[model samples]
Target: MNTRLLFFLLIICPLSAVCQTFTSSNLPILVIDTRGGTILDDPKIVADLRIIDNGPGKRNNLTDKASFTSVMGIEYRGATSQQFFPKKPYGIELRDSTGINSVAKSVLGMPAESDWVLNATYNDKTLIRETLTYDFYRKMSKYYASRFRYCELVLNGEYRGIYIVMERLKRDKNRVPITSIKKTDITGDAVTGGYILKIDKTVGSTSRSWKSPYPSGPRNINLDIQIDRPKPEDLAEEQFQYIKKYVSDFEASLAGSDFRDPTKGFRAFVDEQSFIDYLILTEVCKNVDGYRLSAYFYKERDSKGGKITMGPIWDYNLTYGNADYCEGNSYMGWAFNFSRVCPKDDFVLPFWWDRLLLDLDFARKVKEKYKALRQTVLTPERLGAFVDSTSSALTESRQRNFVKWPVIGTYVWPNGFVGRTYEAETDYLKTWIGQRLTWMDINIESFGVLTALREEAAFTLGPNPSIGDVTLKLPLPTPTDVSLSLTDMQGRALQTRHWPAQPKGLFERTLPATDFNTGPGVYILTISTQTGPTSRVIVRE
Candidate 1:
């Protein structure tokens, strides 16, 4: 065959394959040009980039004065991802003519940002896991979930399949809203807060990390956490010590006997709502690395919440029935229990969640939030529609993507295969999600309620931070002897009442302020049943 015919057969002829399902690409085309055709593993290397809209009919066309930028990195997980495949991810940094970092003009109507990621969908056949996961978090009102736009990529004049141009997670007014740390402001309130830390495996420049004090799994191993902001060199000694000490104190309180204390326990150092929301998202998807890796938490200024928040979820390509290992593809079990199943894994989840699950209050809150979310965000109809719309958007571009890198009918690393073709892959995702949501819906409602301790126990306390009188209520699951104990912050019982063989009904009692010490502080209220002990925090004002 002639060389020209070979070139046409391989590149120019879009429909060379007789079984072509789509003839036209309906997503924007991104063209990247490297000076020496060298995009390295390092994020700093720069290559030029251009945008050409290829969607149906036409959209905003690039102008003559359209600003462009530099690109770097071919693999997303740095060098680790390169070992698996030839095609890799890339990073784009918008720059002005003077080579200074600047925001690029919005492309395909995406928000303007200085940095963006062109993720390679090599591992994920559906090519929508990350985007869909982010969509779920954003809909659930997660703080600063990265927004993304889908587009086709051509690097060094070669087609490189479908890619998503997503906002990079960082501290900025438009991103993670938090106080910016400066080396100059080393003392006092300036250095006390605002830090982003990640629980992940050690890699690259992020080697400057600390190990957890508590051993997590059966191996008695501690996980490593990396500081994302305030580069180690730029961080002051006091700032470093302050953050370390704060986390250490929080961990100490959480592991202590009085871990349920509202004033000095883990609740005081972490945001409750944020934790619940994170748990729902992670558990719903059964992310293999949910708490073990790619887990992020941030702390703000003392005046602003003054607590750590788990947020801005990252890396979900291996989630949502995607992974075959560690029971990731299963629709059963809780994501928080991954450590119990895979304890010997190098990176394990902290025991924080395990301990939290033991707390009845936290479990109840999770159930409540999950119940509310199911009606709106996690509903089967709504989730199915979202997946349908995403598949429709990729209908035309998917053919081109498959043509560029044909892995549809093949296995990639850790996939729990359900089908082969693009349509089959997408159908698999939709069906898996629908089934997963159903499993979660049924399980979450009965989550902590069906514990061996009780079948239908109802507990509530009102007028938190009570002034003179406090009310405690308990609706027992079965007829049994129960004991109510009121204690000070130090776990010393102040008042105790015993009820012999109480029936399965609501029990209400009022504690007079005169019986307790006269002052403002925190106290513990415990109701011990034949099954187990239920605890709550009572504040006396």
Candidate 2:
């Protein structure tokens, strides 16, 4: 066959690329030869310090005056029959209320059993839903490392450990300097701590390939964070103290509390989209002999499924000092549904409004507890000694360490993370974590431009479903000359009025839209400002 004809045949066939490159899936390789390298880049294992020293790796976590530690025991078996690298003990150090290695190893470490992989693949466009599985954790980890690498080495003339970072994807990269993240090697779900999914060299031609639980997890344009899968007992403790929802018989626009009960809220803690997604996904499932494997979901076979509850209550890691990373690195508190794109489907807005302040209250309490735990782990004298002890371990064991925050900024609020410089170095974990938890402050929206302008556009002119007696409230974020007008779908003006002193702050007034030359189906109330006209909908029933 000619070159053109051969190319055409290849186009009609699948696996042509893989077939040309590899004898089988077991031994496939990429051009960069990044394979065979350890993700952690340990100096002892790699030999050359520079290989482990691209820059530095860093960790940050949220903290506050009241924070406390919720340490669990880290158990070490030393060696295990199961194939995994982090074989010794980590939970010991984390759960140890005492900072000392001797106490932590005995108290925190517990015997861990089997490790398993949950493999998944998507051709494309899990779209918005995939953002959770793919983007959030990767960016958060990278940004945390970036900020950490550039942190001051000698905080007030004291030694901080060598830290390295590796956040590799652009989608996870934050643009704003205030966001304190930097570029780093980011991996996905499949990489379980320091384990590999397959071995290419030793397997050779006969070598078969299999997935690694952690490594294979984020193999595509993927994202992963080390999340200890929830145990059955752990799931039982995950319920919220209270969950309330509003079931409005009235239209979404009709704002009133007549139907709202004082004590209990609506029956479900679910939003409309979540409920819809839930209902759709449930019906589409195929029933099998004993199990209904909801596994093959993305088969465009059907776009249906039930609602998946958002999470397992993240953002409290610093409340326990389990990880040395900060929240701003990932901004996990927000951005779950950016790919979802619909105003109605994006639930974070309401979720944030509902939970931010509540999280802060809980965070403050947790913050206090973590601090006291830290003190128990370290004395004023031992604080220095503790730092000295861990410095060598970091350099020997890990790569991508850093000592700075990423580069993004939010509105400068009081008691926030951003300033021209760092005020307290040792307190990095505490202050940094505090600013992160504050992002959920529902009042955060109140301090923003979107809220100000939207509030100015609010009013309730109704007597039951009947409409009239419309009132104007103007408190736009920016000042501009303004005018009010009502318009029908065909661009015909029903009523127009000019306001002379629109003012910088608040303004409210009653309007006469009933007299306009029009019949009522639906009309728009338009507030024309020097910047632009802000519009809201009105019904003529």
Best of the candidates, lDDT: 1
Model-by-model lDDT, in order?
0.70, 0.25
lDDT of 1 at 183: 76
Residues 1-541 of candidate 1 have per-residue lDDT tens digits of 1243224324532344433332124566666656555655665445667666644566422222223334432324443455677668776677665545565556566666676777777788888888888898889865778888888776655566788888777776667778888877667777766788888767665535787788664344667767887778877777777788877788788888778778877898888888888888898778988988878888887877778888768888888888898778876656775654554467878867866766667778888888888888887677768778888888767777777666778888888874667878877888888888877665555345545244324677778888888888877655544566676765445676656556667777888887577367888776655444577888887
- Candidate 2 scores a C-alpha RMSD against the true structure in Å of 21.8
Q: Which stretches of model 2 miss by more than 4 angstroms?
A: 1-264, 267-311, 314-395, 400-536, 539-541
Candidate 2 lDDT over residue span 138-230, tens digit each: 322221111111111111111221211111111111311111111120122111011101111221122122221211100111111111121
CA error at residue 18 for candidate 1, angstroms: 8.0
Off by over 4 Å in 1: 1-25, 54-80, 100-108, 205-207, 448-541
Each candidate's clash count: 1, 101
